[model samples]
Target: MTGPATDVWTVMSTARTIRRFTDKPVDEATLGRCLRAATWAPSGANAQEWRFVVLRSPESRAVVAKAAEQALRVIEPVYGMTRPDDHDDSRRARTNRATYELHDRAGEFTSVLFTQKRFPTASELLLGGSIFPAMQNFLLAARAQGLGACMTSWASYGGEPLLREAVGVPDDWMLAGHVVVGWPQGNHGPVRRRPLADVTYLDRWEEQAGPTLVTEAPPS
Candidate 1:
């Protein structure tokens, strides 16, 4: 962790959402390191309820891909229902294209699904509050090591039964989502964001006088 402040900034800025990836496999040692980092994430009452199911084998990955595809089919129509009437047709076309590409790429990526044991609403929020930060830490650490990843929840739609069966998860477990990791196939660059003034409010919850950058600089 010892480094110049600028080095930290560099790492943060370089972390981006990577969808495409190389075919090379992530080794055991690296995977272990990432999992170990996840263990340090904070939890409610120290009730660290997070569980990870890593799908590494080709067979297992295929199972996940099939389940995810089934889930996406049920979800796509629902998504179409939520769009505005004025939305561009080209945008929808592009989205549909990306959906297929993501599906095809999914089987080759390293997938890890997260879960938590059933709990009351408050406890569930606390568990999520604890787990998500750890998940971010894991993603950032992967980025620092030149790996790329994206978090996706599309698999949670109607795929829960299949996931539970495939992963042998207990009846009381709740599925949070999945994260895919690999060496990115494309470039990483600065992301587009809105100016800060639009979203931020001053002491009285009103807009401030200065121009604001909408997106915070990517986490370092």
Candidate 2:
């Protein structure tokens, strides 16, 4: 298949997380392309035991949405997320509002439940090295298709059992990640990042590679 109509660098730069979606339908072909990209991600021992479950039916999505609701009880407090004052219009406030919308409507969007085979010798973190790259590919592929997407921590946030049973995932597989995909109700632009040099280090951890701009300084 031809590469997506977007440049690689452009896709990477613009592939920001999207939460709110319209009622527009997402076709199977588009999703298949994203999954195809996912299969190309590297895995340990070339033991590609990753499995993906597509949750599109209203019933399945409702299951996820409900779990998301339960998850927020833990997430909001730990993260210190307070309801943004209606008059507040800062970047953090906007992000908070979108995040809340996602939690409320997660089940209404098409999502994928990614899982990896569990082995006696492999810890979940070790297995994540095998599976997360595939999820990255899926995210990039979705962006290339001009679809919006974001990885969800609903499972890790205490929704794993409900999601696993709802999707009938086998016990031998660990729930690696989950992502929501759909036509975006938002815009995609250059992703915000710290100056590369500040984040990147040279040969030694003690060495500063570049001028350290105060990361928390107010934007000019």
Candidate 3:
């Protein structure tokens, strides 16, 4: 288990997005703990309005997976539109291959659908502000506990309606995203990300230098 003071910088630095997972089942107790961690996340006015729908049963997983596949097929043409001709063809090929692998492996993991009651834009931002921290905590906790998980939003396309119907999500609720969790079967490593300097600004939003640091520094 990761200690409370395991060096905040180190924990943040080591976290990575896990895509591939193993067939090992995440136990009920562990899942509950993960949810508990999520609930601890801050929310708008401490409203804690977030709701997590865990899809564990084989039947439910099948329904959601089918819906996801259907939605992906519908969006494939649009995905092509976003790709540029100058893009790295090799990288795109690898990404496409991974997408197909995820499709085939989708049924093996548990799907968690996160939601919140619909709110106006400002309120929604506050609500999201609260939920995402908790989500990141959940992901970090999962990584610490040796579980592989990845946050994905592909289900939010045209599949939202099907998901709401299949999962019995309330009419007043809005889907945030889906998180897939399972034990990892393959290698997990540092993810490629832009440097901090390229993203962060000193004072104003646009005031940034060249790439700050490519890889995160380990805690001293």
Best by TM-score: 2
Q: Evaluate model 2: give its TM-score.
A: 0.89
* lDDT by residue (tens digit), candidate 3, 1-220: 2222244454455455666666678898778877888888787788887889898888878876786677567667867623324455786765665555565677667978888777666566766676787788787766666666778765666778777888888877778778888876554455577866667775677776444333345535
Superposition TM-score, candidate 3 onto the true structure: 0.81
If scored against the real structure, what TM-score would every candidate get? 0.77, 0.89, 0.81
Question: Predictions ranked by TM-score, top down?
Answer: 2, 3, 1
Report the poorest 10 consecutive residues by lDDT, candidate 3: 1-10
All candidates in order of lDDT, best leading: 2, 3, 1
- Model 2, global lDDT: 0.86
RMSD, one per candidate, in order: 5.6, 5.0, 4.9
Worst 10 residues of 2 by lDDT: 211-220
lDDT over C-alpha atoms for residue 94 of model 3: 54
Candidate 1 accuracy as lDDT: 0.69
**Best-performing candidate as measured by lDDT:** 2
